[model samples]
Target: MPRTLRASDTVISGNPSPACTEPVDGEQAEQPVLGGAPSSASLDTLIQHLVPTADYYPENAYIFTFLLSSRLFIEPRELLARVCQLCIEQQQLDEPGLDKVRVRKFGPKLLQLLAEWTETFPRDLQEESTIWLLKDVVGSLARCEEAYCLRLHQVLQALHQKLAALGPGPESLLGADRPISYRTQPQASIHRELLCICSDPYRLAQQLTHMELVWLRHIGPEEFVQAFVNKDPLASTKPCFDEKTKNLEAYMRWFNRLCFLVATEVCMLSKKKRRAQVIEFFIEVARECFNIGNFNSLMAIVSSMNMRPVSRLKKTWAKVKTAKLFILEHQMDPTGNFCNYRTALRGAAHRSLTAHSTEKIVIPFFSLLIKDIYFLHEGCANRLPNGHVNFEKFLELVKQVGEFITWKQVECPFEQDPSITHYLCTAPVFSEDGLYLASYESESPENHTEKQRWKSLRSSILGKT
Candidate 1:
């Protein structure tokens, strides 16, 4: 039998458990069944499982799993308040004769549950209002039982320190500190030595991998939840995870920037020979990304190369070898809903799961992962027709989001190349219109319609200048 953390196991003071430790399929992990209700219990029934009775506390694993994914249906603060209220009500704290008896019975367990929450996902309590509510709840408990006051204060202090440590440091990325528009600096001001410094495709791939890992690390699971939640027209106030969603958007902008950068590199070259070399170079880089299991960059490179501006260069295409590019395209092909890439991603994930070194990493095509999560969220109702929390749906969300959390934790084994990194980040990339103009300049229009487009593009581009 697989050993799971039991209710008696304290979540505080030992080595930290992973964000999730639920048993996989074909395994029987113990689940909390409040009031002997089945897994299909209502949300109110599930919340009761969290309140400790005289003889029972919920399992540590169940608590962690629930708290991690609960945001899909309820806000953390609201949940915390509800749980605390339930505890007070269950203990009958207002009753004069039984107050001491109830406190003696349930006070320690209540403190333990609160500590478990704050310790496991302290970020949920980072908001001032949440912390204030927590302190108030704990204070009321403390007033009822003097022995628990110091322990409660200790939990609050430790949580404060953890939140403080999460703040950006002096060396953190400037772009990550705020939500900024994804605008590239003009080509005239950029370092135009171009790809001369980053000639080795493997080195360029390593640098790109490093950059991708850094961006991935800054995003939190809350960002993924909030990204699709606010789409409901009925959402009133901004969700607490709004800033986190900005981080997710910033990562996406990085992907877009990389795509535009690849296109710009191919189109900006004046000669067909140079354009072909750059195309081949990018293809080689994309291949390296594939071998290294960096699918996001691989897709970005493929996408930019397939854009109309770069794809229309027949002369450039004629000069370059196309065999490997075709294979990369096939792997990323949208046909069959990217079944090929999904298979490749699964292989990489398995490799990472068993490997001793971080070299066996699997950074997925993140936007696709987001889309999958969004669809899953949209497809399922937040509550059952019977008004339960939809525990089954929450379990599936845990599995998907948990996989991403595992991927994000792998440290990039590649060393950074500062000059190449600077070049990649600061390189000027043209907008779509500029790309069309660049393509026309390289190869004159083939027909009357094409001629009209080229003339109009030239007039518009010059007018912008």
Candidate 2:
């Protein structure tokens, strides 16, 4: 009484063909297989039942069928396409529904199908679609176990080999100047997906390590380091550098990232000894730049380590000044001595000038030194056991020195000419009570010249005025 199915309707209508002319006995056709007895038309019934739902079934069913069926019996591409679609849809939804859906029921099946597809699929489409799907699946499966993470790593390694064979052309898997537009969509999506996964710290740590390795292999280590460092939101707050590619700013960024990885849960490398080893590794990488006289890079790394501020840093300026004096005393090349002195002076000037405006940079060394000097000379001397010296008493001794130095204004004889007279004439003198002595005068050129000669001779022979 039922309508007969036609060959033309089989694919679309999910029916068996009418070409089988053998008549089914009524009882055999009507009876259900029971007690482990084989059905008369098991294969035909399966094909008929499965065909209708194949296009509309959910991920769990597709994964199940792919694993249970022989490779020859299923279209792997279509199966993987369904898996990818399921992942895309799942990711897009606000509620992931992972708890309601059973990954345990489906995970092994999916992994098995993936392994088979990796061996059998067309190389190009396999590299493009299948590998990407596997990466997503691996990212999903990351919540499972160390074994699954290891399996995903193996898959990625195999995929990378295929990608590498494409050579240096556009087909190459990685290139620095590859258009940002190509990366923008996937990277944005992946970043969001990663953020979601990172809620599970264990999974995130594994995923981060996996991604780091991928980046390291695809790009060189320096570029990998830069990608993380440059992407850091805090980088702008720390320091800015010139546009030069090779500089302290670049190295500092790299150093900071390495430290961040070691110190945080992102790497999960939390032993004190291990951290020290990582720091040592970073220093070794940095030493190459340091050897080329990159003091700025060295300083940046040292600062990032957050080590105790070096006690000897205070004495650095004094040591530099002393070394310059030594060079000068030994009659070394005056130019080198002058250069060394100027370097130290400029460094000191920069510190002092910066401190005058921004007190934060003034370390305790200079502050304490200034405080002690002022206390010893100015503080101790003024508050003597007796009353303060009267202004008239201070002036009396000063007047005597003025008269002794020059009876009349004169050109300084300290040097051969009038040009040097100003310095000699303006020199300060002090009385026995530590009061300052000073004088001012105006005189004709002849008197100025003679007075300056006597004052100069007295100063030179008797020590400075």
Give the top-scoring candidate (TM-score).
1
Which residue pairs in candidate 2 collide? 409-448, 410-448, 411-448
Reference-based lDDT, each prediction: 0.71, 0.30
Residues 1-465, model 1: lDDT tens digits: 001111122111233122122234433323434234234446676777767866778887567557765666678888988887786677766445456666766778877887888765777887888867766656666666776778878888888876675565212342232222112233343337457888889888888888888787767666777665564668743333355476677778788888888888888777899889999999999999999899999988888887888888888999999889888887876655667888999999988878865456788998788766765665565654445565655566767888887887788888888777776676666778778777888888788987888788767756532
Residues 1-465 of candidate 2 have per-residue lDDT tens digits of 001111111111223222112233333342222221112233223233222121232233322222223122224455555555564354331244543234444454445545544532223234366666666665665554336657766665665665464223211222222111111122231232212222333232222222222222222111111222233445642122333213223333333333222222111222334333434433432232232222222223333333211111222212222332233222211243223323533454345443432211111111122222222222222111222111121122223222212211222112122222221122121211111001111111235654574355335434445
Residue 173 error, candidate 1, Å: 4.6
Clashing pairs in 1: none
Q: Candidate 2: global Cα-lDDT? A: 0.30
Q: Which ten residues in a row have the lowest lDDT in candidate 1?
A: 1-10
TM-score of each: 0.79, 0.20
Model 1: residues with Cα > 4 Å off, grouped in runs: 1-38, 52-54, 91-121, 140-189, 230-244
